[model samples]
Target chain A: DAGITQSPRYKITETGRQVTLMCHQTWSHSYMFWYRQDLGHGLRLIYYSAAADITDKGEVPDGYVVSRSKTENFPLTLESATRSQTSVYFCASSPVPYEQYFGPGTRLTVT
Target chain B: DQQVKQNSPSLSVQEGRISILNCDYTNSMFDYFLWYKKYPAEGPTFLISISSIKDKNEDGRFTVFLNKSAKHLSLHIVPSQPGDSAVYFCAASLKSGNTPLVFGKGTRLSVIA
Candidate 1:
């Protein structure tokens, strides 16, 4: 309850359907990030938020949308989930830029 | 292109021995480096970090060495135990806040007793 938490630990959705992955942090960190981990790729950042309303794209942002309306929540949305988007999603929160604490991760499967 | 590369997919080390994991980076702008340890189903936890100004940073049993000229870095675990077996990820950042980190594929360390 004191650290970051991710919702829907496991999910299976059809291609073309919209799916949202939720991330919540109790530390109220100023920086929050979303990353997807694949077999060959370790962790590619999808999006990051600096503050409540400031967000920016990372290495892999295509097809994924993120928003941070409040300091505690940063949600990632897949407008049209594709099979290629199937990967384990991770959410992290940091008080600064260097150190990060991650959630358990959400395993998303698209078919 | 991947800015950070961990080359080794996995490593095996005997218990009570030292385990060395290496990382290389292509970006010269990166000024900070960090190491993270991850379990099978858990997100990575921060292990150690070093700045460009210092070549080595040590904490407890974990130590990180950075070679700025070669754009290389390494994490060394002394007297590694079975509990130290996990996937280790290396990440680099250019600045603090807002900028996203570039991460390497990660190296899985297996400490066999």
Candidate 2:
């Protein structure tokens, strides 16, 4: 209730289908981020929001979209899912620029 | 290019022994470094952090040493226990900015009893 939480802990979708991963935080942190973890890549930032209605791309943002309509919600969308996009997605929130708290990641599989 | 790198994919150590996990960063702009521990099927949690100004920071049995000149850092867990077995990740961020953290691939540490 006081930390970040992600919806659809596990998801299986077909290629070319649209998918959205939801992230919510109760802390009302100013910064929220989305990252994907792969076997060799570790965790690469996809997108981040400094505050509501303001979003920016990170290291890898291709084929992915993110939006922060409210202080507590940041949702990531996959316009057209691909098999290569399968990975564990983590959402994190930070009150400041330094420390971040992560939610239980959502494992996504594209077939 | 990978700004942060963890050379070791996995490491094994005896219980009650020292466990050292190393990390290297190529970017000189990074001034803040952090270590995180992740369990299976869960997101990583922050363990410790050190700024570029300070070479060492300690918390409980976890200590992080930073070598700015070498662009390297290490996390030392003293008297490591089986419960400490997990994937450890190193991350870096700019000193004064909104830049997101760059993470290393992570090293899986196992403390055998």
Kindly provide the TM-score obtained by chain B of candidate 2 when compared with the true chain B: 0.98
Q: Give lDDT tens digits, candidate 1, residues B1-113.
A: 98999999999999999999999999998888999999998999989989899999999999999999899999999989999999999999886433567799999999999
State the lDDT of candidate 2 residue by residue for B1-113, as single tens digits: 99999999999999999999999999999989999999999989999999999999999999999999999999999989999999999999995975778899999999999
TM-scores for candidates 1 onward, in order: 0.97, 0.98
Instruction: Provide the overall lDDT of each model, using Cα atoms, as 2-decimal numbers.
Output: 0.93, 0.95
Q: Across residues A17-66, which tens digit of lDDT does each residue of candidate 2 receive?
A: 99999999999899999999999889999999999999988889999999
Candidate 2 wrongly placed segments (more than 4 Å): none
lDDT of 2: 0.95
In CAPRI terms, where does candidate 2 land?
medium
Candidate 1 off by > 4 Å: B96-98
Q: Which candidate gets the maximum TM-score versus the true structure?
A: 2
Task: Report the poorest 10 consecutive residues by lDDT, candidate 2 chain A.
Answer: A92-101
DockQ of 1: 0.75
